[model samples]
Target: MEQSHQALSSKSEAFIEKENKYGAHNYHPLPVVLEKGEGVYVWDVDGKKYYDFLSAYSAVNQGHCHPKIVGAMVKQAQTLTLTSRAFYNDQLGPYEEFVTEYFGFDKVLPMNTGAEAVETALKICRKWAYEVKGIPENQAQIIVCENNFHGRTTTIISFSNDENARKSFGPFTAGFIKIPYDDIEALENALKSTNNIAGFLVEPIQGEAGVYVPADGYLAKAKALCEQYNALFIADEVQTGIARTGKLLAVHHENVQPDILILGKAISGGVYPVSAVLANNAVMNVIKPGQHGSTFGGNPVAAAVAIAALEVVRDENLSQNAAYLGVVLRTGLNEIASRNPLITLVRGKGLLNAIVINCDEDSDLAWDICMKFSEYGLLAKPTHGNKIRLAPPLVITETQIHECLGIIERALNDFR
Candidate 1:
């Protein structure tokens, strides 16, 4: 595989060496030295540009360094940066109004990252269960799917099935029941398993689990089951929201609204860390003052950036673009799959998609394939060992999409 690509430039080696010397060995990022990004492309320090297929794990749905989002952040930073929930700022009220209205929710609790939004949602659900749902204190349970990837926080990882994440994490948080993804029967059974069930926290489409889009009506049926059992259906749209999945949210495809809606990533157009959990007053009202918040959660910069980012999604019709281009991308992929035995399966929704390489989960074939992709001027990454997630920024045009597909095809041919 080393013969297939050029050696790392000295500048790249220096940056990598610095990180290895000073940074924690947490992430095994692809050996590339990216220094710049604009729209759908990112340039390495050595100036080799590549299509940004990963999109910062779908955080840059509005594309990289979007003028509107960056402009909003910069404009807000210059005017006002931080006024915590202790003191209200001009940006927070408008952001609350706009976000609640945009997502058709009664209220929103803003946060700074996807995991924080998820953690916020869990706290809200548990609080609501105890306060409103009449669940016994300290006994409320939330159901999660197997092979889920909500985040890396201690509480979040407690329910995760991935052993590597759970190893040495110790004394996992209790009160979470695990079930299979896309299984309505498993959901009903779990809901029936406990009267103290607080909610069912789920990813509308399990992105980190290799873009595992569920069956049609799985979300709607799950919501109905939640209603049947009086458990809140919390949809973690942190990765699947903001037009990455062809709809405003993946749940929109099924016309099901989550009791607690968690959003992050593209909410700030990848320029700032912004996340939020939205729910109606009845559920959100459980929290009193000083109950939960972050110092920078509702900062002016996040609010301004999120407003602009969401507006860009609406004005640019990112949802429509994703829906149309999804068909194009998938059709091209299926054609490639038909001719290539190496690619075993293609499945996903909208811009969030993946191709399963014909290898075991422990195999490094997908990682090596991704390395070849990087060498060919296209950037992508492997998840769960054998799946190459192919989500580019929603701002990517059709010509760019075709160009990326060509790169992928040529790169796969090299493997052949």
Candidate 2:
């Protein structure tokens, strides 16, 4: 029997109509609809090519549809996919060993999304506080920073300062102390002023808060303060880990090892959904069997994909490339900013960089600028209202980077 299929057109209007009619309206994505991607570039449904500057929010740090990562996933999908953690699969133990050793942690608890991994860390921190640190049950407090973007879950959003993410989503969870980001004094004071404090959760660089980088020595000092107060230092590297930040982990910039590390996004090179919580025995041991688990968390396919992804990070020397290219990117953008009055400031580390538009937060200038960028064959979007993050895949070449720089300059120049 022969199977037949309808040939789709390169025109984007009808496809966009289908999405608008049926898809959830949660995200206000750019008008362009991407249908294919390879390395640093993507093609729209209309067959227009553009540089992929966002990299799926750093999930595709290895690049779009990387052959090695996709190959590993295909092989594993053919072999074994899931066993539900009720019975261990062969790949689970090996992956646990590999990731733990790679990240210099004693153990790894696998999950399928960044939010789940964050929730896992939060649970571990609280349990360790109650059982190991001798805090009374139901009294553990975890400190979080303001303007943080951990995830969209109810409990995760409880401490979010973003009104849009939190509005009408609560009766929010309690026991989280909110303090300003990059403030060492505030963190130290919070630690000293509170008891039953389980952990201090932070992003090494606040990616969703418009790519806000902390002051020098802030992470190291904050970790020391957590040590002094016997609270866990939790680094949520969901968006900044896996060579996206010119290092395996952004916290490496400060030479600080977190008490518990939460990771996701590029863990499987964006080929599959995989996330993990890594910690030494003292913190991880608090979670007993039957207390915490997930159905597809440590599935064989996820294990294999993550292994190949981490291997790619190591084999490709992506961290070094990101470091070099980041400097080139920032320097290029800074020069462009000098000539163009619209781009106010450029900031970030590694490929995870952004340019601030010279406009008010409520203005449409940034969004309009992104539309201009799309027209100019470069794809990027505004983070808040006026800040646009430009993190391309780590595998992007130096030549392609400069080419994209030209596209950006043209976009800024042409924007009215």
- lDDT of candidate 1 over 69-140, digit per residue (tens): 898888889999997788878989999999999999999999999999999999999999999999989999
Query: Which candidate ranks first by lDDT, i.e. highest?
Result: 1
Error (Å) of candidate 1 at residue 10 is 0.1
Off by over 4 Å in 2: 1-10
Compose the digit string of candidate 2's lDDT tens values, residues 1-416. 11112234547768877888999988898878798999988998777899999999999999999999999999989988888988978999999999999999999999999999999999999999999999899999999999999999999999998899989988999889999999999998899887889999999999988999999999999999999999999999999999888999999998999999999999999989999999999889999999998999999999999999999999999999999999999999999999999899999999999999999988888888888788878889899888999999999999998999998988777763
Q: What is the Cα-based TM-score of model 1?
A: 0.99
What's the lDDT for all of these models?
0.93, 0.92
lDDT of 2 at 123: 96
Deviation from native of the Cα of residue 386 in model 1, angstroms: 0.4
How much lDDT does candidate 1 score? 0.93
TM-score of each: 0.99, 0.97
Query: What's the C-alpha lDDT at position 311 in model 2?
Result: 98
